[model samples]
Target chain A: MDNKLSEICKQLDQLALDILKLCEEQVKCRVKLEEAMKPGFVHIAKSRYIMGNRTVCSLQLPTEDSAEFDALTTVVPQESITDSEHRGFKLVETPKGQDTSGKSVLRRRKEKPESDASTEAKEENVKTYVDPIKWFGVLVPQNLKMAQNCFQSVLPLVVECANVQGELQRVQMKYQKLLKEKELLS
Target chain B: MAIHSAIKGKLISVIGDEDTCVGFLLGGVGEINKNRQPNFLVVDKHTSVGEIEECFKRFVKRDDIDIILINQNIAEMVRHCIESHTQPIPAVLEIPSKDHPYDASKDSILRRAKGMFNPEDMK
Candidate 1:
């Protein structure tokens, strides 16, 4: 009897997890669309433009306090703030050496191109970087990072979905038990 | 009931082709438990039926896995074992692979479920 009850519970548990997975997928799609609608969220064409033989990669300014249509010129090589004033638009400097969890989903450039090397070195610790290959070039870094944050932030939504699934399963199990009990009684 | 506690640690196991296994692994469902055992099995062209059967048996016996997702096509290869498995926990689900989409007609569970009711029950 206990075995049968537990088996039912186990099925319920599996269904609950499936509910959570589906809810997460739906939330991701909707959140990505809404996030994309925000100002400075969309990357302009100027960033990846090629000039002459050299492909000049222009990084966007940190959009926190930027006006509409605020953009950037090419980043200074040594990353001196002095060059900011000389350049037409402000260049939000990429942080040199800090690894911020859940933010700045920046890939290590050609300097650390061996993909596994940096990850392996950090393997000893609880590494928080999402597997790079998962979303490497799919969404731009800013959009991807924002989507990740939104996903984590809305975990409660997934939890709620799981709770509802659990309740529904419990009701189902009880209904089955009642039917079985009635059969035995008769 | 106490045995259920031992099985409550949630993890997803997989028995699938390269594309299916790689897709789930990339989704961050892959894990190597403390015993250095992976929760996934990648079935390649060189993989034998015996090896696939052994891995399926091992995954079914595992306490941590709450779900075992098998590519529907590969599940067809081990239909006997799948048909015999009655446990509701470690629920085995059939998923579509890149090369092969799911066919409801070939699903063992669905076939078994259909057998449970009388012709009158359908009405």
Candidate 2:
């Protein structure tokens, strides 16, 4: 019981640190974004039509990581506990040396069995990657491009922040459960 | 049908003021699904709280969206709706707008995390 409580405490401490780092990164990203925006506002304000009514970007959800990085919870069996009794569970993450490359998180083409004509058409639609800036008129100002770059770079950070927040929540729930159990035992 | 969508990637949606929407959309996270629904909403003073809540709820229910970015000040108005969502897939990130700076204390996820530990221990 004591060991379990201490483990929970340690996990909480690590998650606290992760949140702090994420917050700092967010601040930095905001600064870069504002810098990118500062030079463009005057131009963008004048040409309001550049803010088109429709979006040209396509949706491509990142593929889930393999089983190891999957956020699924698994019960960690304790020898002393019977199968019917409640047992502790832990959320597994990729161990060291198996870090996921954020760039590679983009979804791969879907595999499907179809006629030759349909397959070719689907492949054409999926394979073509259009530059989103083209949605705006050609020869947009440099600041708008800079803002786009800033947002693209910050995309990975946003994903990382979300992952950390989810993990923190999971760990916090576990910590609360252990606290309850410790009280019952005492 | 399930197999088709399962293999496809997800999208990042945005609900923010005009500047924030235009900036991120320019970054290429925008999309209009098969249903002719655009993935973003550009909020202004004319936008109602009810409309914002509805858009947020729609985004939460969509299978394609992986992330939802809302301007922090706009999120302040719809705090209850954002807090009610607990799913891990469609992450709700409150971002800074041109007019309002990011406030950690007002952020739902950040504040929850801050509450978990004492300030001294974090150091």
Candidate 3:
């Protein structure tokens, strides 16, 4: 009887260890899956910041009034447009008649009203004007996803931990009850 | 499911009875209101509306608080406070109380969905 009781105790200890290991493995697997799904960056327009691997200002060209400046340019500025242009800020005339360049081919293809020449010239002027500075930041989708998953993954673990804790409490209580019963019988 | 990095170390304490606040507290998410000024507060059925409102006012004033979770029943009493808080931090959430059922009409989720689906009806 003593040998059998010792064997059962060893088996129970092994089972507990296995359960804990399994729980850890499950958490690890879930974390890997969650890491793959994270977004590159959380762009907060209100804060004018991109939060990802690190917090960075969303503006490509860093400027004091970047938000306000970006807001002003509804049309794509010509100076800012980088294709195969004048490498480091060069004044280039807007192709007025027909642009052979593949980069501007799509824009040139669009039909414009003959009456809108003045408007077109005005737009071109706005594009050609150079402001020289750009603010931008690299956003890591993995970091964003990892952050999100961190919160989501906690819920199940918490529930499982609670359940296991409750079970352990019940098991202890039952063991105590059985010991009392044995005492009473003896 | 943002990582809630802002509120992680800071206390997001909950106040009230076992049934109402325990679930969130046990989940290891929000802080429990233990009479101390918490970054986030969760008020339950046992917590009075006046107490909740007073705490909420304090929470809104504090820069640290990011969110507040209050029992929907208790929130009904302090509707003015809930409506008036324009600050981004200390966003008030009306959750279901233990005794009272979660009413879709009062809940923000349902309200937002309704607004999205039937915007014209709202007018």
Candidate 4:
């Protein structure tokens, strides 16, 4: 009983440390976010201009338990760069969080096969990707970009916080169970 | 959950004051589905507790939403609803808004974790 209790105690201690570290990260992210927003207030204070109904980027959800969380990946239109007949939005995964090498991976997700096979069917499969930043204005100030970067950085941190919180909850339950067993044994 | 495979990617939904939504949306986390349903809710002084609860419940029900980032103050307003959520998927994260800073003492998950530590044990 004493051995089990000690083990639970160790786990609890580790979790406590992890939570503290996560809190520190959260604070730093919050500060950065606040700093990032400072510029937006001066440049894009018009509530109507900033408000938009659509999102151009989507988070690549973790598929497996061990999968690394990803930041929102936005597909930029290559209309100006290329006049290619096939105007499919290229999905590029930005290098953030664990991707320390800082190389953006140009990868595309497999699209669902269409039922009707027509030449126009190819166009139907293509999604028009709009840059979310454009929602603000054509000529947005650098502050808006900074705010986006700050918020983008917070995604992985939020995921880590959630994972640690889950672990702490599990260990807390185990500790409680062990305590009950120890009392009964005594 | 199997449907997650067919979908391209998941979304991080937001439920907070106007500033929080605007800031994060600029980060490119906002999305309106084919159903014309937005993944975020902008709460103002006119926004009621019931409205917040309703939007939160809606976010919880959304399969495409993997994370819900709500302002800590708004989360407190809907604490009962937040507590009832037990699933690990679609994590409900209480973040600090510009107006109200984050208070760890009021966080549901952090508060529960804190309870596990007894002062006597430290000694």
lDDT of 3 at A21: 49
Q: iRMS values in order, in angstroms?
A: 18.3, 11.9, 21.6, 10.3
Q: Each candidate's fnat, in order?
A: 0.02, 0.19, 0.01, 0.21
Pairs with steric clashes in candidate 1: none
- Interface residue Cα RMSD of candidate 3 after superposition: 21.6
Q: Give each prediction's DockQ, rounded to 2 decimals.
A: 0.05, 0.21, 0.03, 0.27
The prediction achieving the highest DockQ against the true structure is 4
lDDT of 1 by residue, B1-123 (tens): 343222223565678875445434433445554355767788878889999899999999987665677877899899998888765555576655556655656765545433433444222
Query: How close to the true structure is residue B80 of candidate 4, measured as C-alpha lDDT?
Result: 97
The CAPRI class of candidate 2 is incorrect
> Which residue pairs show collisions in model 4?
none
Kindly report, for each predicted structure in the order presented, the TM-score of its chain A compared with the true chain A: 0.30, 0.42, 0.27, 0.40
* Local accuracy of candidate 3 as per-residue lDDT tens digits, A99-184: 22232445568776674888877644332112211122234334333433343343333223223323333343344454444335
lDDT of model 4 at residue A137? 57
**Model 1 off-target regions past 4 Å?**
A1-186, B1-9, B120-123
- Candidate 4 regions exceeding 4 Å error are A1-125, A180-186, B1-7, B118-123
Ranking by lDDT: 4, 2, 1, 3
TM-score of each: 0.44, 0.63, 0.31, 0.63
Which residue runs of candidate 2 sit more than 4 Å off their true CA positions? Answer: A1-130, B1-7, B116-123
